[model samples]
Target: MSQPHLSSEATDPASAALPLRRVLPAFAVDVALAATLSFSTLMLGLFGWAVWRGIQLAQQHGGAPDAHALQAQIGTPPVLFLIVTTLVSTGGTALLLYVWRRRATAAERRESTRRLGKPSTWGWALAAGGVTFLFSSLMSAGGRALGLDLQPSNLDLIREGFARFPVFLTLFAVVLAPLYEELLFRRVLFGRLWRAGWPVLGLVLSSVVFALVHELPGLNGKPADSTLFLILVYAGMGAIFAWVYRRTGTLWAPIAAHILNNAIALAVLQIYGDAPA
Candidate 1:
C-alpha cells in the first residue's frame, strides 16, 4: 500500500505539476545556505586580514591604530584569503549537504545511494566531461566569430592565484571545487526544483545563477555584448552539469565531470600560460 502510493506520487500527473509551496522552502533554504557560505568565507578573509594588519600596526605604532591608519596599511593577503575561504566554503558545504541528505525521504535516499553505487556513473561522468569541453570550445569559437570576447575571468584569477600557491590551488581547483560547486549548484539549487516537478526551471535558473555568481566579479566596465556572451558560456557549462546530474541520478556524475573539465582547463593554462620560458 505505502509502496504504491510512493510510486504514484513519483509518477502521477498531478505530482508532475508545479508544487511551488512544497518546493519553495527547500529551494529558498538552498539559496540561503549557499549565499551564507559565500558571505561567511568572504567575511572570514577580511577579518583575518584586519587582525593581521591591526597587530602589525600596533607593534609599529606602539598602540591600537585608528581605522584611518589601518585603512592605509590595507593590502590583500591573497594566499591566506584563498586558503581560508577554500577550507571554509568546501568543508561547510560538504557538511550542509550531508545533513540535507540525511533528512531526505527514504525513497530519495535510496535513489541517491543506488546511483552512487553504480560503476557506470563514472563512465557517464567521463563522457559528459568530454562532451561539455567540446561544447564549451564551440561556444567560445562562435562568440569569437561574432567578435565577442569570451575569456573567462575566473580562469584568469585561478591562473594568477595558482602561481602564488601552486599545490593548494591545484587541489582546490581540481578536487575541492568540483565537489563543492556541483553540490551547491546542481544538487541543492537544481535538484530541489527538479524533484518538485520544475525540471526546466531548475536547469535555467540554476545555470543562470551559477554563471552570474562566477562572472559578475569580472563584468564591471565590460561591453554589454561581451558580458552577455561570457555569461552564456558559463551558463551553458552549468546547464551541462545539471543535465548530467539529472540523467545520471547522482551528484558524483557531475562532480567527476566537473573535475575532469577543470583538470583540462588547468592543464591548458599551464601549457600556454606565462610560465618562465
Candidate 2:
C-alpha cells in the first residue's frame, strides 16, 4: 500500500513475486483515502468561509441597498483562511498515509526491505532536476517548431499568491506537494506498472498520466496546438521522476527534484515578472 513490493523474510526472490496483484488493490485503497481526506479538507474550508462571512451575508440578504455591492464587500476568502486550509489538507494526508502504512499487512510492510543501494543521494536529486529542465526545454522547442504559440505556465498566478504568504507556499510547494505526488505517482502507480512487466510501457503510461493531471487544467484558454507540447514536457518530467525513483529505490529522490523544480519556478516568477507582484 505504501511502496515497492518488498518481500517478507525468506524473500519471494522476484521470480515468484506477485507484487503486481497484491499492490493494485492496495493502491486503490490509498487513492480512496487520499481523495476522501482531500474532499473533507475542501468542505472544511468552505464551512470556515461560511462561518466567517455568515453574518455579513445574512445582513446583505436582509435588504441591503445593493446586493452585489454587499457581496463584493466580502471579497475573497482571507489569505489566512487559505493558509489554514492548505495546512489541514496536507497535514491530514500525511497523517493518513502514516496511519495506513503502519496498520498494513505484513506483505505491505515488506516494502521497506526492497532496498537496492542507498535510498537517495544528493547527486541523483540534482541530476534529476537538471534532467527536468533540459527535457522540458527540449519539448517546448519542439512545440515551437510545430507552429504552437505556447504561453507561460499558470504557475505565475499561483506563485503570486504564494509570494504574499511565503511561509505556507514554502511548505506547500517545497515539501508537502512533492512528498504526496511521489507517493501517488511513483510509489503507487509507477511501481505497480513496472511490477506488472511493463518496463518501457510502464514508464510511458505513468509519465503520460502524471503529465495530463498537471497540463490539462492549465490548458483552458490556451492555444490548441500547445496542448500536446505541454503534455510532452510534463510527461518527460514525470518520466525523469520515475527513473529517479527507480534508480534510488526511494521516493526522496523525486521529492527533492520536484521541490527544486517548483522552487525555481516560483523564484523566476518572483524575479522576472508576475502581474500581482
Candidate 3:
C-alpha cells in the first residue's frame, strides 16, 4: 500500500478564499492560545519564585519550605505574566516581519505600505458616524418596544478612576485603545477577511468577536443589563468601525472615531451621573 500523503494543497481552496472561515477559527484559536500561554508563563514565573525562595530558605534554615508556604509567599496576580507573554508575542511578530523584509524586494515593501497605509476619506467617517447613530437609535427603539430598560449605567468607578488617573485615562482612551484595538480588529481581523473576499461576513464576525473580547474578565466588567443586548450594541459599533476601516482603507479614521466616541461617553457619564433605572 502506498504511504498516505499530507499536503496544504489537499485543503479546499474555497475554504481558503472565505476569509471569514479563516478569521473565525483563528480568532477562537488565538483566544485559546493566549490563555494557555498566559497560564504557562504565570506558572513558570511562580516556579522561579519558588526556586528563589528555596535558596533563601536554605540560607536561613538549611532546607526548602513546604509547598503550601511557598504558594502563599508567591501568590500574585497573573497580570505581569500576561504582559510578558504579550511582549514576547509582539517581539516575535516584529522579528518575523523584519526577517521577511530582508528578503522582500523594494517594490514589494512599497506595495505592502501602500496597501496598509492608505488614508481614508472624510465621507467614510461621516458614514460611520451615521451608521453608529442609526444603530443606537434602533436598539433604543427596540428596547422601548420590548419594555426593557435601555439606559446607560452610572459609571461611578470609571469616573472616579479617571479623576484619580486623568493622565493615564487619557493615554489609555486616546492612544493605547485606538492603536491596539484598530490594529487587532481592523488591520488584522477585518483586513485579513477582506483580502480573503468575504468582506461582509468578515465585517460582522470580527465585530461580534471584538465586542465579546471587550467583555472578557479583567479588561471590562460583565454587563448588569442583558448581555445579548449589550453584545448587539457593541457588535453594531464594531461594524461601524469595520466599515470605516474598509471604506477608507486606513485605520486612523476608525481609531479617531472610537477615541471620540469613548471620550464623549466618558464625559456624558461624568456630567449626568449615570441614567436612572
Which model scores highest in TM-score?
1
Per residue, candidate 1 scores C-alpha lDDT tens digits across 195-277 of 67897888998898888876674444567787887788788889988888877776778888988888877887799762110
RMSD of each: 5.7, 5.5, 9.7
lDDT of 2 by residue, 1-277 (tens): 4433322122222454455566556555655675677668868887778656866676667744365665676676766566567567755664566445423246534543453334445588788976776666566666777877555454644655586878777777667767766666665556655554454555776687677656674444666567767777778888888887666655666777888777765666568652110
The whole-model C-alpha lDDT of candidate 2 against the native structure comes to 0.62
Of 2 and 3, the candidate ahead on TM-score is 2
Quote the lDDT for 212 in model 1: 80
Greater lDDT among 1 and 2 belongs to 1
Q: Once superposed on the true structure, which residue ranges of model 1 sit more than 4 Å away at CA?
A: 1-14, 64-69, 90-94, 97-106, 116-119, 145-147, 217-221, 274-277
Task: Return the candidate ranking by TM-score, descending.
Answer: 1, 2, 3
For residue 56, give model 2's deviation from the true position in Å: 3.4
- Best-performing candidate as measured by lDDT: 1
* Candidate models: Cα lDDT each: 0.71, 0.62, 0.55
| Residue 166 of model 1, lDDT score | 86
- Model 1 TM-score? 0.81
Off by over 4 Å in 3: 1-120, 126-134, 137-157, 216-225, 275-277
Which residue pairs overlap in candidate 3's backbone?
none
TM-score of 3: 0.58
